[model samples]
Target: MKRPERMARLARAQRALAEVAKAESIAANARYEDSARQADEILDALNATNVLHGFAVKAMADTLRRNGRTTERLRRVADERASQYVRQERTAEVLEERATQASSEARRKEERQRIEILVSSPRRR
Candidate 1:
């Protein structure tokens, strides 16, 4: 090939490689953003549920107090509410963990794809 022609080809290849790299980076970043959005949604839902639970518990406590309930009954209600709260917390933890795992997997997959593309590209002699 003529010198100018070879240089042009090299430049074209370099541009293509840069474009591909940029696309891959954008895709990976998009995936990360989507995962973060999902996590935020889950957290918001958990917070809303927790707030509702708190409101319900408070209402019940207020009602009991207004009705002149005994200490034993109040204690039992508090215990039950505590147990329920613990269960909800456990569920939130599981959901958060799953979200993190999914994000990690997505990142790994993106890395592998980038590596494969790099390795498969034709190298100039």
Candidate 2:
């Protein structure tokens, strides 16, 4: 009877060890799954950030290109307008010089006519 009791106690100890091992395995599996989920979330966030940065950089490049084209066009227009102003000033100077020459010629003709009229008229004694 003493030997049978000892055998029964050993069987109960074996069952307790098996239950503890199974519980530990279940907890370890749960921890691994939680870590996997966190890793996947981090990867997704990194991908999204990379895509946004790419778009922002592209937009900035396009804006700079457009500004460069606009600046070049404005410079061309300024050059053309400056040339036009110079042409107009030259034309005004030519017209003013011609008017001065015509006035001088008219004065000389009037003075010659007055001298001939005085010489042709009879003198009063």
Candidate 3:
């Protein structure tokens, strides 16, 4: 080929290569920007999830604490009631014992009076 023709063709090739390089660079930058946006979205979602988990854990702990306190109070009440019942039962037993002793004493007195009356009136034959 002639020198001028060859030179013109080389220039055209160089221009084409530069255009392709510019297009590639633009595409690479767009891809990088999209990837960065997705990463930011993922980070935001993770942060929100962590916050929700923390709140849930705190609420559950509070509920457990309240339940524990309630159970302790109920146990204390039951123990006090049991003690009162035992005291009442002991008092009833003591009263019953006293009543039995009094009844036995009265029966013995009546038997002695009957024997005296029968001995004194022994001339009815």
Candidate 4:
């Protein structure tokens, strides 16, 4: 395939990849939100309780601590995925622009070649 066409195909592939990345980022964000919400609920439960056995209190505190850590990890993962999506999106846009430029350049070159041929050819008269 021609350079311009190949570039265009590559750009399209990049766009697809970017879309996938965006979806993944969104999913990650949702997971992070869910985890955070669960952690908050756990915290609220811990605070609302006035009477609890020693073992139950320890278990709740341990669960809350674990949930907090999981929430933080999920948040970081979501942030990383979002950053990756942005990078992929920018790469797709740049590839599309380059393809357009290549196509334009090819057209201009062909036009110049045609003009040169016309100017050089002898008249049939």
For residues 7-125, write the lDDT of model 2, one tens digit per residue: 44544554455455555555555555554555455444545665476656655556555655654555555555555545555555554555556556667787999999989999979
**Cα error, candidate 2, residue 42 (Å):** 35
TM-score of each: 0.42, 0.50, 0.50, 0.90
Per-residue lDDT for 1-125 in model 1, tens only? 64444444555555555555555555555555554555455445445655466656655555445434343444455455555555555555555555556667767888999999999999989
TM-score of 1: 0.42
Measured by TM-score, how close is model 2 to the native structure? 0.50
Residues 30-60, model 3: lDDT tens digits: 5555545554554445455654666566555
Give lDDT tens digits, candidate 4, residues 71-112. Answer: 899999999999999999999999999999999999999999
What are the lDDT scores of the predictions, listed in order?
Answer: 0.56, 0.56, 0.56, 0.93
Clashing pairs in 4: none
Which scores higher on lDDT, 3 or 4?
Answer: 4
- Please list the residue runs of candidate 3 whose C-alpha ends up more than 4 Å from where it truly belongs after superposition: 1-55
- Residue 23: error of model 3 in Å? 91
- Pick the TM-score winner: 4
**lDDT at 65, model 3:** 60
Model 4 scores worst on lDDT over the 10 consecutive residues at: 46-55
